[model samples]
Target: MQFSIAFPLAALTLLISTITAQAPGSQCGGIGWPGIMFCNPGSVCSKINDCEGLHGSLADQM
Candidate 1:
């Protein structure tokens, strides 16, 4: 059915978009870092030693 094909295609598109859009382990909040920061779903930005960054497993990793 058209629904079946559409569902999988939509899911694939979403996954690819998520991967390309988010920078899971990249730097987030810290001194001398002037930029907006964000983490992927199911995680939060936290301090990692001297610089703040995202510290959580990504969806693809799980």
Candidate 2:
């Protein structure tokens, strides 16, 4: 029983993590934006100044 529960829990965690990973050039954060803020591997969240406010963009690795 414990094994059955643990397997589902682990799968859910992995699914959630993948869902939150943002691709390069994707928006990760900004004022009033309620979404994932983590960038995928080889990318970093960067601030982009716009008229509204500071937004986040996934910058590719240098």
Candidate 3:
């Protein structure tokens, strides 16, 4: 069987943008991509930039 990375990449990119875009204090970040999530107005979101160190997969992040 053959697999295409483009699809997964695209999905990740989409999730990174959509999920991260929150209106309030939402649990954003930790998608194994590093520096993707964000916080809303008067909210705080901790950004973890060392996902590779934990040695995990994309789903594992969630």
Candidate 4:
């Protein structure tokens, strides 16, 4: 039916618009949203707390 084609067309348009309308990214250590571009290369987007080293550390040499 027409419903099937219309549904897929609408979904495709929405997906394309969302992808194309993305905003620019910020640099490393810059203040950005958690889900957004919050960091850059050679850096991470982690909470700077006392237990920072315990999170991203290696557990085993495997």
Query: Candidate 2: misplaced stretches above 4 Å?
Result: 1-16, 50-61
Give TM-scores for every candidate, taking all chains together and pairing residue i with residue i: 0.40, 0.47, 0.30, 0.35
How many clashing pairs in candidate 1? 0
Each model's lDDT: 0.64, 0.62, 0.49, 0.40
Report lDDT (Cα) of residue 20, candidate 3: 59
Best by TM-score: 2
**What is the TM-score of candidate 1?**
0.40
Q: Give candidate 1 regions above 4 Å deviation.
A: 1-22, 58-62
Candidate order, TM-score descending? 2, 1, 4, 3
- In candidate 2, where is summed lDDT lowest over 10 consecutive residues? 51-60
- Report the alpha-carbon TM-score of model 3 versus the true structure: 0.30
Model 4 misplacement above 4 A: 22-62
lDDT of 1 by residue, 1-62 (tens): 99999999999876775664436566667777675454555655667766665545545345
Writing each residue's lDDT as its tens digit, candidate 4 over 1-62 gives 99999999998876675553323222212334334332222233334543321112122212
Candidate 1: residue 35 Cα off by (Å): 2.3
